[model samples]
Target chain A: MKFTVQVNEGPYQHQAADSAYQFTKAVLEKGHEVFRVFFYHDGVNNATNLTTPPQDDRHVVNRWSELAKEHDLDLVVCVAAAQRRGIVDEGEAKRNSKDAENIADGFRISGLGQLIEAGIQSDRVVVFGD
Target chain B: MSEEMMDDEVVKKMAYINRRAPYGSIYALESLEVVLIGAAFDQDVSLIFADDGVFQLKKDQETAGIDMKNFSPTYRALEMYDVEKLYVSKESMTERGLSEDDLVVDVEIKTDAELADLLDDQDVIFSF
Candidate 1:
């Protein structure tokens, strides 16, 4: 089955990102297709490349990037949400004249239309959040 | 498969789960916004109001003092969008000392088990 996953909270601060990652990984391991993993609300924090966690802590941002690379996954961060929280891509940073871009590898910033398209195309849409 | 079978495929069951109260945070209102936008897709949609989420449908919500827009009236307009499958958790309402009379809209009250059964049949569940 094709599934679309949505995460609604930030990484580290909440268990939502971890659960969403685990769920996505498990589904892929079971030979199911993940159509897209949409990061909305504070969930867009998962796509920032600037987070520098303690040495012992899991690198949540890198984990998502690697997973997407391994499975050829579509990791989408909501543009509206990302902008609100200052998670920007190269183009956005350039457009807004910011010094740097913080979007992680393997994640693309898009509109809510992508989310709606996922709902239309996927067999199931599962959400993880507080 | 026959062309007729392919063309007449069944629509996926979509469930919108609400577990937060309105006004305190943006979840309840944002969830409602998604539901309203999703109505245009014509999918099989159902809504679940659980935990403090039951407060979202409470009657006579006064937002004037808080300086926030009171969106309780949107619940009544849901029917116009053909999005009528609203379910409220009986346990949640009882714990909060609220009855159907306190809600602004009519809803089918179900126990956790019953609600679970309903959710099990859904193809998709968007929890807010």
Candidate 2:
């Protein structure tokens, strides 16, 4: 089955992001296709490349990036939410005249329409949030 | 796509899992918007009220003091949109001391295990 995962909370602050990541990993391991992982609300924070966690902690952002890279997954961060939370890609940074870009690897910032499209295309859409 | 074309597509079971109260945040209201718009796409949709989400269906909500519009009435319009499958968590209601009488809409009250079964039947689950 093709599944789209929606994450609606920031990492560490809530278990939503972690649950979403684990769920996605589990789906992929089961040989199911993850159509896309759409991040909305505070979940957009997962796309920031600027996060620097301590050595012992599991790097949630890096985990998502690595997973996406390994599975050729489409990781989408909502543009409206990302802009509000300061998670900007190179294009958005240049367009908005921002000093630096912060979007992490393997994630693309897009509109909410991508979310709706995911729902339309995927066989199942599961959300993890607060 | 045109409405006629949309009607030809396979209908998927989708549920909007409301887990928060109204006015506290934007999730409740936004989820409602999605449900409204999604109904037009001709999918089999339902709303699941769990945790603090049951608070969103409480009757006699007045937002005058908070300066926010009272959207409780919007739930009433859900039926008109053909989006009437509403389920409330009995455990959540009991936990919050809320009964069916407190709710604005008539809903099927389900236990946690039954709700889990219903969730398992869904093709899509949107939590907000």
Candidate 3:
């Protein structure tokens, strides 16, 4: 089965991101294909490299990066939502004249078209949101 | 498959389920953005307004005091994008003391059971 997952809330403040990650990992373990993971609204916060948790705690951003690396996953953050929330990539930083880019590894910023395309292509679209 | 092939052959019934109020959270706005973009895909689309989401289509929304851009007018323009299937939960409207006349756009009102049947027919359901 091919699946596209959407996370619509920020980490820590809500459990949606964590649940989405767990669900994605479990789906892969079960030999199902993950077509894409789309982060929108506050969920874009999960793709920021600036996120740093205590040494004893799990790093939500890094967890996603590591999972993407292991599975060669496509982690997409909606560009419009990212820009609204200040989650800038190197290209976006340069385009918007910002001083820094905070997009974490294994993630790319794109338009909402990607989300629609995922819905069209994937067998199922699962949303973990608040 | 080639991009053109996918475009020509693939069509899905996509439903945008809105349950949030218009102003307090960003879900309503974010969902609207997705609906607008999804319009370009030429999929069978339906917009379901339930709970406080019915308020999003309320006529004469004034956001000046809140300093937010009043985007209620966009609902009326949705038809221009060929996104004309708009439905509201009958119970939600009644609970809010709103009627069809209160809305900016014309829409079909469905009971909870009917709404469930409608959603069950969708290929994809986007919850907001």
Candidate 4:
């Protein structure tokens, strides 16, 4: 089966992120294909690249990047939501003359169209949120 | 193979809003899991977070400080599970003295009014 999953919360302070990941992993482990993964709300901050956890902490950013690459997934971060929290991609970083590109790799910085498209394109639209 | 297979099924958009930190309790994570179960069957899904919910994305967080499990890392694995739409409120980040640099993953940020607009778009909303 194919699934479109949307995550609207982060992993740190929000358990929604972890729950969402587990659900996605379970679906794929069950041999399901994920059509798209859209990030929004506080979930948008999931794309930020400048996270350095404590030595003992779980490295969520690295994990997300790995999953995206391994699964050939489309990680779409809403551009409007991303920039509002300072999650800038290479283009936005350069455009704003910011010293950093906080957006993560293997993810597309895009609009809500991708989300709506996912809704229209997937067999199931599962949300892991709060 | 195609999304159209579920077109005949009713589609409703549900937004899950996370408005707290990563630790201190399970108020946010557990609540979200309950909803994912529903999304698995029927309904479209959207997740949103405002206010303190933005803190949930901070990178490299150790719940040891609060005697909790470090679950933030689990978020990165969400894509593999097929849950990928994450949102944070722009105003919340600003008020919390955080920037995208402070976060640990990929996300979308919106302002107060925009958040409201998104809530309007959803058929159901859950907040933590």
Where in model 1 is the C-alpha error above 4 Å? A90-101, B1-10, B64-67
Check candidate 3 and list the clashing pairs: none
Candidate 4 segments exceeding 4 Å error? B1-128
TM-score of chain B of 4: 0.82
Q: What does DockQ give for each predicted structure? A: 0.31, 0.27, 0.72, 0.04
TM-score of predicted chain B versus true chain B for each candidate: 0.92, 0.93, 0.94, 0.82
Candidate 1 backbone collisions, by pair: none
Clashes of each: 0, 0, 0, 45
In order, the Cα lDDT scores of the candidates are 0.89, 0.88, 0.95, 0.72
Top candidate, metric TM-score: 3
Measured over the true interface residues after superposition, the C-alpha RMSD of each candidate is 3.3, 3.6, 1.8, 9.1
Ranking of candidates on TM-score, top first: 3, 1, 2, 4
Range of the 10 consecutive residues with the lowest summed lDDT in candidate 2 chain A: A111-120
The CAPRI class of candidate 2 is: acceptable
TM-score of the first chain in candidate 4 relative to the native first chain: 0.92
Fraction of native contacts (fnat) of each candidate:
0.28, 0.28, 0.84, 0.00
Cα lDDT tens digits for candidate 3, B9-125: 688899999999999999999999999999999999999999999999999899999999999999989999999999999999999999999999999999989999999999999
Better of 1 and 2 by TM-score: 1
Q: Give the TM-score of candidate 1.
A: 0.83
- Please give the RMSD to the true structure for each candidate, in Å: 3.3, 4.6, 1.8, 15.1
Top candidate when judged by lDDT against the true structure: 3
Please identify model 3 stretches exceeding 4 Å from their true place.
B1-8
lDDT, candidate 4, A18-48, per-residue tens: 7777787788789999988888767877777
Model 4 per-residue lDDT at B104: 69
TM-score of 3: 0.97
